[model samples]
Target: MIAPRFTAALACGLALAGPASAGTSLVIDAASGAVLSSENAAQPWHPASTTKMMTAYLALKAVREGRIGLETAIPASKLAASQPRVKVYIKAGQEVTLDNALRIMMVKSANDISYVIAEGVGGNVENFVAMMNAEAARLGMRDSHFTNPNGWHDPDQQVSARDLAILAMALMREFPDYSDYWNTGAVQLGKQLLLNTNGLVGRYPGVGGMKTGFVCASGFNVVATATRNGRTLIAVVLGALSGTERTVKAAQLLDDGFSKWGGGYTLASLPSQGGRAQSICGDVRRKGGGVALADDADSSGPIAAQAQDIGGNASDGGRFATAAAPTQFSSSVLTRLPSGKISLGPRAEMTPVPVAFGRTPGSASAPLAANVTGEADSRVARGNAPVIAPSAPVAAGLFGTQTGGLYADRGRTASGNGAIPGSTTAFAPADSASTQPGESSGPMRLQGAVRSGAAAPASLRAGAAAGIKPMPRPAARPLLVKPSPKAEPAKAGAASRKPAQAAAKPQAAKPQARPKTKPDDDA
Candidate 1:
């Protein structure tokens, strides 16, 4: 039922003055499913990584039903390894616990981990998707349909802003105990400190849990839930031009819900405001590089796959806008939000949750930790935990395990920018380059082996002594400089005349006999 206050506002000509030009925005009360305000709430749009919300809901449901356990070990199958970056880079046969996988998928928006979760929880991708669609229908997400586990672009897969609110509400209400999975601000996986893709997580005071998503086709989208004064609200913003816009808009929606707005109607009652956003990549590419190029490699969660131009440039600012620049938000976007200010203050210091590869310790099925030692690579410890390499045998197995696996160090000089492991180059999210001001600059390059200047492990030295050859240095490519034309006029004229004579006569020259050389000449 539509709330009286909302009806009064609309009747008083407070309906949004124009069509929702900035994609869609919907604000709703978490407790009642009553929508406080909305624009284009019923319009179908791509969910992007926000699709992971449904993926998480279903996975948690499986856990509650004993179909899967949080500690269950799942392998990154060949299919998972083949997924593009904004991933944990889990290769086939490598493993992570279900708990850590969920945390990484939510915080880093890792596509491959989503695939592992789908396979672990639902038995396979196809079956998992069927389960997703079934759950959407059950939850009354009438405008939502999922075709893959990660929200990769699929023309056929889409969800309305209202549908997403429904999904978010369902996740929070049904699985309140597991809200940490979505609410977490950062994840420490081995040495990589992966900040949550949703910039609002630590910055927004009441920002509890939810997800952010993007694809050129979808623009920047987020389903953010926050609480203040005991009232929880969910905001869905889709098709924002940049991550800054997405964060600011969602923040404004939540702020309004907490203060001035009262419920007007149930989310289902909102009528469709028809129109679709022009693809950000299409617009940027057409403009010859106006905005940050969307990460063409980002697949929404593992729940949907759409064949679209998913490849493009990285983001403008990293995923979250650094607090250093308050000007990142455009005035055009600021005008749409209730408070015309960018409320994203400095990022809050989050105690990152640790997530490690392979199964949890002590499980009967867990692989035994090998005993070989030296400093483990920085990436072996979860979160900001102390760096500890896996035992030598396990470390050897993990580094460069796949054709393009975790090891990016093949020909990398002491500086981090080295040749990537495989024949194909990896595409990281635009923001992957700079998540925060002081954090690692190159999120895509995971550090393998010892840090620069560190002594090699004794085992490694012994291996070299035992005749194992280290990677050969890549040869420097020779530059070919064309010889300058001779200064002699006679030679120039002769060269030109020869070309003309050859064209006119088509004569074949006799082969010259091989010249004999003295020992000195040969040497």
Candidate 2:
């Protein structure tokens, strides 16, 4: 059968993004290749920024095919720098290192940087994009296309939630270093430090690096990843309305995926009612691979590990290539991984409960859905993990805030404080230096004069003094917390009373002892 096409991808995507459907979400075990939880997994829709996954895929392939190197420099032409929003603002003639440019584009989601790199690697924007389409076809990205490197918007640029999940896995497998940037919390470019748009990077448990995309037509789209035990899973949520909504939705999907113990069925149980279950190539039980999960070893309720009679179909993207693909600029050169730190394990396992299969197709309990697709093969293995089912609703809201206005206000506050309280705290979580004005939040205390040219009280002052004027002195935290009014009298008395006051007139002048007068010095 012919593979799905780009135009059909957009039409099919729009058709799938119904109000009732909200498009489908999938949480697949990257290791076992098992479907943990699926909601409308077949729907199609505009890919938004997640389309960059295809872009990254092709770029990595070029690296694999001998075309570009991470250190290769690309010039920003008038056309390349014209795009706006989330940019490092490279001027037309300025040269940006390919490695740094991608760090800006992937970590910061810079539209202009993408164009610059596309041209830098392919010699021109259009030709680089042609490479993107060519690579997508080669990878069997049936429901995808690229008119622009930065997913600004076009009926022509489209991908399905399922295809996106597959694409994400491919990128992770192909370009480990480049993919690691997706998890980067922020980027540093001269005067400006751009933060990652993916909220799941530091907030939700197990979630790592991935990309975020938005457009009026696509709402919000995110290709999210998480790791627990040794297993890593990818979730694709398309057409979400807000960043918070996207993370929460993605987290919910991850929870469902990690919740399964993937307990093994007896060899007989695996065969199913009639024929041998279509074998996925990399299921953990397969020859050399196994799925990884954290915590539960034996089982988590009834795992959705039941086998199916698929017609032996497998993902077109091949198994994890044992060796890293060759780089474009040179075979010997390998791009160094970007440095960034962030992670929180998936939430502690909830009480073990039965997984509901009513809404799910091919669940452990329900007969595999009638509409089940073809047979598949994968290399996956068993690992301990907490159980959460996707069919259930996720109760928590996502982190990150609205764009501009309150968002900018929050960023100013969170960065100042050092810790972004995320969506939960009263005062946005801030770094300690933010608590003291004119100081940074993270680490590395300023050796210079702090506020009033005085020393910072504690060593906690770590971060930038960028926006603050002269900075403020670190005030005692007690002052910020309301002090009791009644204690004022006691505190004042203690300050005023002299050390001599505590001594009586010696009850009398004992032997008329002469006492030395101590000088009163406030300085």
Candidate 3:
């Protein structure tokens, strides 16, 4: 028989271990910091690129304090250039505007770009990292620390789901004016276009701007926000298996939180372990443990593969294996909630400011219209293709309808400008040759000839009209003559008369050889 005191202590130990060992997830009301649901909220995990949030926060703070303007030039340094992959590849001494650098860092998740901004704003990466930690502690993110601005993997650079939630909330609440920065789906840097990595940006309905991060050690993580019926909520998901899985799980969490939202306990009421998250990097097959429930039941069982689907139907329990079950409440929980809706936010309407390089710091330039056409000429001269700015409104119909996988328009030639011919917005030279059948003597004329089944030119036109002269057209190619078919071979028995005919035809005499000529003396 076991002692009553021992059994009671054992039960308490199991209960405490439940929440401590569960995977990290949390949802809270952005306005009141109310915790709607959470699991393993305080377990420390690698922040990955999500560290950009802190970097961005500090940058925005600096902007508010008048320390740096949006147009301030931030030069890339050797330290900034040495960062690992997922970088903008900006060389040392080159500079990017603070505004453009932030967009590139967030949208592209560029490691080097983060460093550029870090050095520019924080005076050095170490100083910036120090500022990040100081701010983290000030915001009550006790379980978080920063070793780098870009969130590149370092054992010391870490954050908990709760800490991330706090940072995200502070970002939204503190910098309402810059909400569109993270909200934007894509940005254009000269000819290079970068799309946001946050899959929930355009896919999940009402989902607003946030960030996403990933590394082998951290798996995939996201701090996502959504608004519906004038109510806004934020969800943090960590240690997901794939990009799709992270997004789907985050969406499901938002769906569950919103469905059950009724102003519950505030963020301060939720428990915190104040410890680092258990490293699952060594256990590749233990993905199921990340989303486990904080209860004594075997909720850590492997989630079904179907739960990975973003549009998958939920089970009768009102939960997909990928989504954490709602924490028990005094009221009965609804078995089913409305299906996840498409994010109807204004993400489509938001446009990133065009990033220009080589401009003097703080000098103003005319706003380039999205429909502007002549910019490609200079880019082409420099051997860099210009991209046609997208002008169409966001596509409608369903989630992820904006565009196919991150579209990149390297650059276009004068003739190949990405616009309809004859339009004012068309990017072509005044002397651009018409390809019409009756017209001739222009760059496109050869193309017209080929399309019309007429004689084609040896080469197409080259060079823009305003710069280098076009190469001369090569001489037209001569047509080849076809050989006639050979006559049938003579039959074996019928060929005997050919010898007599040959002797009669070859009776001509040979001429005598001429004397060899000597070198002329004075001809």
Candidate 4:
């Protein structure tokens, strides 16, 4: 038996090593694979949805290998359709293009779409899982393993912060062309619009693209990449207490790494440890008399408004009229890692609470239903403008009071104009009045007839006699006059023709007087 003092010390050590040891984080230089900052970087942790990163990697690999093309159609299988919420709800028989599937998987974090992609690329879910592990191992990710294509919680599925960083860097290096898929803030699928689960995409400046994950066993996790001033850094934050904390901590790590980025220790130089944190799952109490909250909030909740706005703008030929390409990687930095054997440690086993359908792994709430489609644009546009009821007919002498009346009848036919007979008001012919008092009325004269300028049109007088209310007139506008250029002195022979020219010019007609009416006639 151990001595009493030794036993007491062992208990203290075990207690100290509980949940506090679970939170692992790391930041690495994307170019050199150098480790800039780390905390329990080697400790095993659940990947949650970040597992989809590996899924994406394999799909891209297939595309590069010509096993599949971006345009290849992927049919949804029964297994794929059976996936829980946060999905596009593709019918099992329905097929989506490989490119679209990848976008949906990344932007929506849909488990169903992941399976669809897996089946399309690897022929089946099991094969896809095998391919994922094979790729992870090939990339020196000994501490990482994948059991499912969509990252549904399984005791065997796990990845360390360091391993995740390696996978992220490998993806950037191996496939630069498809980088936009991961960085997309949102995607449109027919009528449905799915917003990205990765918070840093639009929220953090300089953050290009990445993946976020959460599971009860993993807490909250994110593998984020950011570039600034030619330097790019990848941050792996695992077991964060909350989604906000996960984003904040990842941002903080990137900031610190970028600040001290020049010449750091290589990833191979970092120490490795075995065993997973058992207490990292639920809410953990911290030192400040506050508890570290579990990531109970849905990641999509904060971005719903943004998603709606984007969907609404898609149809208007506005900001999203054209498909947006992903932000490109900054100029490449030449940094190489020293050759060394990557240490592989024993795998740690922890009981994983299976993430249920309709709810994300660690989130307490289900994702908001983002069924936003083209109709959203119409809805939003309708909401923005005030609705106007039909106005009552304008009274007889109430012309020149409404706006836009001057040109209102310009597009209408004579019969369409609701002119009233015997009404005091009428629509002035285009040639009769000048928009501006002293502006040149070029081409205003009719070739033959010389009707009175103020006379109402025959159609207007007929309508008025039939008791149709006269069309409302436009609001009076201030008339502006440009001074006519001083007439040049007439030439010698031109004086005799001046009288004829004056006679040829059309004269402005005088205003016609209205007939006096009895009091009853005024009605």
lDDT of 3 by residue, 1-523 (tens): 2245543543343235333223467777654454566655666788888899899988876665445556566667898888876665677777666666787777667788888888877778788889998877666677788888998777777898877887786665445435545655555454454556776564455556578887656767788877654456778987775455566567667776666532323444333455554544533235434332111001112222123222111111111223434432111211222342222112222222334343342323322111123464421122323332322211010111122111111111111211101111111111443332222234211111012233222222221111111111111111111112442212211122123221222111122222221111000
Tens digit of per-residue lDDT, candidate 4, span 1-523: 2245543533343233335334777776664444566555666777878888889988776654445555455667788988865466777766655655776687668788888888877778888888888777665676777899887777778887767887786565444435545665544343343445665554454565678876556666889877665445788888765556666556556655665532323444333345653535435334112443423122422311100011001111111122221122111211111332111111111111011111112112111111112243421212233332333212111122222212111111111111100111113233435322321222111111223243333221110111222222212111111122452212211222223222232222222222331111100
| Candidate 1 per-residue C-alpha lDDT over 1-523 given as tens digits, one digit per residue, 9 for 90 to 100 | 3455644443333223233334666777654444565665666787777888888888776654444556566767899777755566776887666767887898778888888888877667898899999877666666788988888777777887877887785565434435556765555565565667776665565566578887666777888876554445788888765566567667666665555333333444443333442344554233325444332111122111111111011111011111122333321222322343444454544444445676544333322111112244421222342222222211121111122211112221211111011111111111354332322222221112334344322221110011212221122112111123544322222232213221232112222222331111100
TM-score of 3: 0.56
Which stretches of model 1 miss by more than 4 angstroms? 1-21, 261-263, 271-280, 284-343, 365-523
Better of 1 and 4 by lDDT: 1
Each model's number of backbone clashes? 32, 53, 9, 9
In model 3, the Cα lDDT at residue 248 comes to 55
Error of 2 at 106 (Å): 0.9
Root-mean-square deviation (CA) per prediction: 23.4, 28.9, 27.8, 33.8
My TM-score estimates for the predictions, one after another, are 0.58, 0.49, 0.56, 0.52
| Model 4 regions more than 4 Å off | 1-22, 262-264, 276-279, 284-523
Best-fitting candidate, measured by TM-score?
1
Candidate structures ordered by lDDT, highest first: 1, 3, 4, 2
When 1 and 2 are scored with TM-score, the better candidate is: 1
Which one wins on lDDT? 1
Candidate 4, lDDT over the whole model:
0.48
Off by over 4 Å in 2: 1-21, 261-523
